[model samples]
Target: MAASAYSDHPELCVKDNFKQSNFKRRIQVQCDLLKEDQCSAFTAISHSDKAIILSFRGSEEDEVTMEVVDAITVLPVTEFSGKAKVNQYFYDAFNDLWNAGIKNDFLSLKNANPGYELWVTGHSLGAAMASLAATTLVTTKIFPADKIKLVTFGQPRVGDKTYAELIDSIIPYAYRVIHKNDLVANIPPQFLYGYHHHKSEVWYNNDMTKGQPYLECDEDESKKCSDSVIDLSIPDHSMYYNVTGSFASNGCKGWNVFTQ
Candidate 1:
């Protein structure tokens, strides 16, 4: 179920060229840097299934900017009623976009599509934003916690232990999927930064074989999980959604796979 959410991202990126299939409403979201910093995402509604998907795009600009944002340590979740703390940069970025009408837009969509199940997803930086968005949705009472589902690929640690506990308890179905050797998954070093991920992880091994299966790691934060192990490489981060072939050897990038 979670993996399928990721598969929808490629189509969501094709804004102008998008063809409305199962999705009845497609809202393109790109927060101008002057207005709300660099935040971009899209929300689509599937009336047939009563599902609302909020997908965020990965970094498409300067890598230096992304590194700077990722380094913004920790801050309290004071923006809402939660006692938990989150990555300052992620929260600030998400807050800026939310305040710029994304929140109201989402709420309006929710009201318009009553009874629709909300699913949030993204990759890389987008995944971090998605996590913050999910947290905000629950914290603000815009929607009941259980009514939302979050599934992110190559997601970094968004908050501290308390924040992890809070999200895990509230969101109900949060799945963080990591591919083997994907360095982005081991970001914001836990020991050095005191960051932690939410409970429940789905790990796919490096070796892709006919019978190879994804492992479900221990849900407890103390477990550390497979993602806790250090493996800093960007190629793995881009290899998801059944994409095969060596990215480096083929002179191709992950984004190329999606764009092509």
Candidate 2:
């Protein structure tokens, strides 16, 4: 679904993704892509399996970072009762997208699919949005934390230690998938900026190919995993699961178009 999020027409790309997968049953792509100048996401559902997916699209470096460079300060989030502080830009971006439209579409999807599991994912900047989205869903009582599964790739630090722990405690199944030395994963220079990632870092020790070795570090920003890499490379950030493209079905290693 993360790959599907990149398409101009997600409804068609997602169906193409499902068709290419191993599942015996297909998912329902109920809407077009959720896109804006700064962020984008796509939603799909499998009624038979009682599951829903919200996949956010990665952004170009220049476009996403511009929002951060100007609003680099960290601020206490109102939703967390001023307890957890986060990058003001990340916070604003999430709220802007949520209040603008994603919230209503999400709520409607939930109401229509009772007992369905929520699976959220993204890459790069989209990873930031996905992190906030999952946390918001739980904080707003939209879904019990346990019912949501969040797995992001090349995820940067979303907040400070307190905020990371809050996300950790709430989203137990969260996993930040980092390719070996993904430059984006080391953003804000860690402690220098007081930003930290959440727990369970899934690090692919080598090139992330079908049979490559990987590790799951239970500590947030674990030094024992991807954090251990001394040399960081930006190119590594764009090739999750061994696919190579900017941020679409092409990145997932295959492409096809179908009329909806």
| Top-TM-score candidate index | 2
Cα-based lDDT at residue 84, candidate 1: 74
Predicted structure 2: lDDT: 0.70
- When summed lDDT is taken over every stretch of 10 residues in candidate 2, the lowest stretch is 23-32
Evaluate all candidate structures by whole-model CA lDDT and list the values in order.
0.63, 0.70
lDDT of 1 by residue, 162-183 (tens): 7788887788888887877676
TM-score for each of the candidates: 0.75, 0.83
Residues 137-251 of candidate 2: C-alpha lDDT, one tens digit per residue? 8887879898899999888777788789899888988999999988778875665557788898989978876667789899987889987878988779877776643445333
Native RMSD of candidate 1 (Å): 6.0
RMSD of each: 6.0, 6.0
Error of 2 at 129 (Å): 0.8
lDDT of 1: 0.63
Query: Stretches of candidate 1 above 4 Å error?
Result: 1-37, 61-69, 72-79, 207-211, 218-225, 244-260
